[model samples]
Target: MRLVKTEKTGRSVHWPTIAALAFLVPVLLTALGDAKGAEPEHRPLMSFEYDPSSEVDVELVLAVDISQSMDTDEQEVQRAGYIAALTSEEFLNAVQYGPTGRIAVIYMEWGGVDEHFLVADWTVIKDAATARIFAGQIAEAPLRQVQRTSITSALTKSVSLVNENAYQGLRRVIDISGDGPNNQGGSVTKVRDHLVSAGITINGLPLMMKTSTNTWQAMLNLDHYYEDCVIGGPGSFAIPVKSKDGFADAIRMKLVMEIAGLTFDRPSFHPVADRRPVRCDLFD
Candidate 1:
């Protein structure tokens, strides 16, 4: 071993010092990697964490229902619809229509009193690649279910989740989809009203499945119930699904509508025939 001298200062670099740096280079890299939350490799000898901030036209929360009222087959159809919509070329095109060309999305599957499960955490979908990756993740997630329908719980959870997130947006929305009424939680109207008044929109995807059921879980005029109670905000509306086969198309239309921020004039999603108004206070 020999020293590499510093000619300008006439100082000799010792072999021991050179050996010490050689030994610590990898260790230092690993320390930097640990500073980040996680990485591909647990102990990365070298890595970089890129944290870039972005703006978007909206922050949308896809709050879906997994209550038993939706049978396993209907659940499957609903899940499939979202996967198709999220990955569709239309969805990708909708993203580009935004002012910033990106949006933050959160996906939740809920049922029961306090039942809220995150199928996908906060993710920025800016391009086809990112959209596909998100769609694949949701496509692969295990289908889950619980008892009861708590629209109130879903609303509360969504508000908390959005408030705790890191992204800032010009608009914030909770796209709540459910097949039944509020049969299991706190006051849905109160929570819905609070969120709407705070400038956070609540959109609805009122699914009309199990329409003929004679059980306590059955909800007739769910679409009207949603309009009277659940959805509210600027440009907010409910696009009801009338059957299993129409689920995907409904999902796609709604996604494109929300992402593009299109009004009733958008060809993809036309309004359903208006039903007579229901009691917004029916659930209390």
Candidate 2:
């Protein structure tokens, strides 16, 4: 979907709200140390160096799957793909379009209700150097244990992050990348409905590498599941990567489309009429 260009002045940036207690409380507590009054170790403030004068267009949250279904090799491929995209020249070209065309990405791994960790939070990548650093950090971080796929919880959490931040962008999107169907927590459709109603877009990247003889059938089924249950908002679409080798290209393509706020002319990939059921192979 094309993002509507909106005028943004300094006053409209919500600096006061950004400085409010909700954001400041943690900083204050850390600076003051524990209740015993001992000096706490110093840490850098969580802020980005992007030029605010440039046009701001998109805020994206990447909710990645780390469920037990994805083995270590698969996890490595996923992580590497993102890192490569961050450093690619194509991504840099995408960032230069707007005055301050910045993409604030929050990298998170989600499985079960209790198994989401923020590997990277709200980092703005405006230049190639910064993007490379962010990618390196992501590459070095250890993959956490997976539990279950909770599409509803991940969507809810991503929406909250975007709402809390002050972004003068034309579009807000949640990019969910997973390899399995939702089998835990609340209904995925309900969450998608709520996010759609709030004018937020949800896109899906379903990984379909592990299916046996029915690989194509499994992908078709998974695509249908995502369309019916997880994707929403204007111009939302799902792009499936049939194998690990396809991950980098898929992500790069999606990023380009998203950063440009481009609309999809063709209909999104939907399931064929006679697809088979997704056996609970990952869960069992």
Candidate 3:
């Protein structure tokens, strides 16, 4: 059964969905069909065989949200944001000044539970040319929207992607952007802590341009939710996009910070074992 967070007290209450049998039958069938051999049973966090030649300054995973809540227009803007960020001068400069003068990146979009689409595979960006090629790949892919918000599943997939990629880096980061809270999967904080323990940093781009109408679409204090629940590890922080016009700029600044290892002045949201302000498992 799924647990939902009451808006007022932040207390979790469980509910059975058996009353919606007619509506859920097809969804369950579809989910089962989609899950067939989609992912491996076990994936190591890192490969034991490390190649000295494959080292880079950072391994960055861009986990974008493409849930139904993000309209097509917003999706276009989001896509444009990343494209611009990747090719921006600031981002290029950050890479150039890095210890290895290069970083490995992968772009992936997430929506429902276990649903993730890797738009761009791991590519080393040491200069503008390679950055443009990576951006072009993102620009070329057709935009898609899936149901639900599963940041938990997305982060899990990211770990697998990092493990499978043939690169070693001084830092590993998963930059996840979303407009809503986790409402369709396992506990997000559990996975966040796992990643942090494995020496991975997570940053957030919490899009707060629209108010939440339903549990699936958005939430109040999304920035706080991101801070208290989503992001973790050293130097991890969340940037809230309160307006559409700021997407490109926010994305560019975030990219530069992650690549350059620049620390934000804001407070770090690393999870404390006994004290959590936001219930990461508070789902819809």
**Superposing every Cα of model 3 onto the true structure, what RMSD results?**
25.1
- Report the candidate with higher TM-score, 1 versus 2: 1
Q: Per-residue lDDT for 187-223 in model 3, tens only?
A: 8989999999999999999998785444533545687
TM-score of each: 0.76, 0.74, 0.77
Per-residue lDDT of model 1, residues 1-284, tens digit only = 68787879978899899889999999999998887766565664787755456567789999999988677898889989998899899998998878888899989999987889999899999988988888888888999889888999999999998899988877898999998888767678889889989999888999875666545334457777887788888888888887788999999988898888865755223244544566666665
Summed backbone clashes in each candidate are: 0, 4, 0
Q: What CA RMSD would you report for each candidate?
A: 15.6, 21.8, 25.1
lDDT of 2 by residue, 1-284 (tens): 22233376324434465557678899888876765587668998899878564336788888999998888998999999988887888888997785566777778889987567888877778898779878878988988767788887888889888888766567889999988777777677777888999899999988887766556546546766676667888888888888888999989878877777765787566343445533432332
Give me the overall lDDT of model 2. Answer: 0.78
Cα error of candidate 2 at position 114, Å: 3.6
In order, candidate lDDTs are: 0.84, 0.78, 0.89
Residue 142 of model 2 has an lDDT of 89
After superposition, candidate 1 runs with Cα above 4 Å error:
1-52, 212-219, 265-276
Sorted by TM-score (best first), the order is 3, 1, 2
User: Which prediction has more favorable TM-score, 1 or 3?
Assistant: 3
Error of 1 at 251 (Å): 0.6
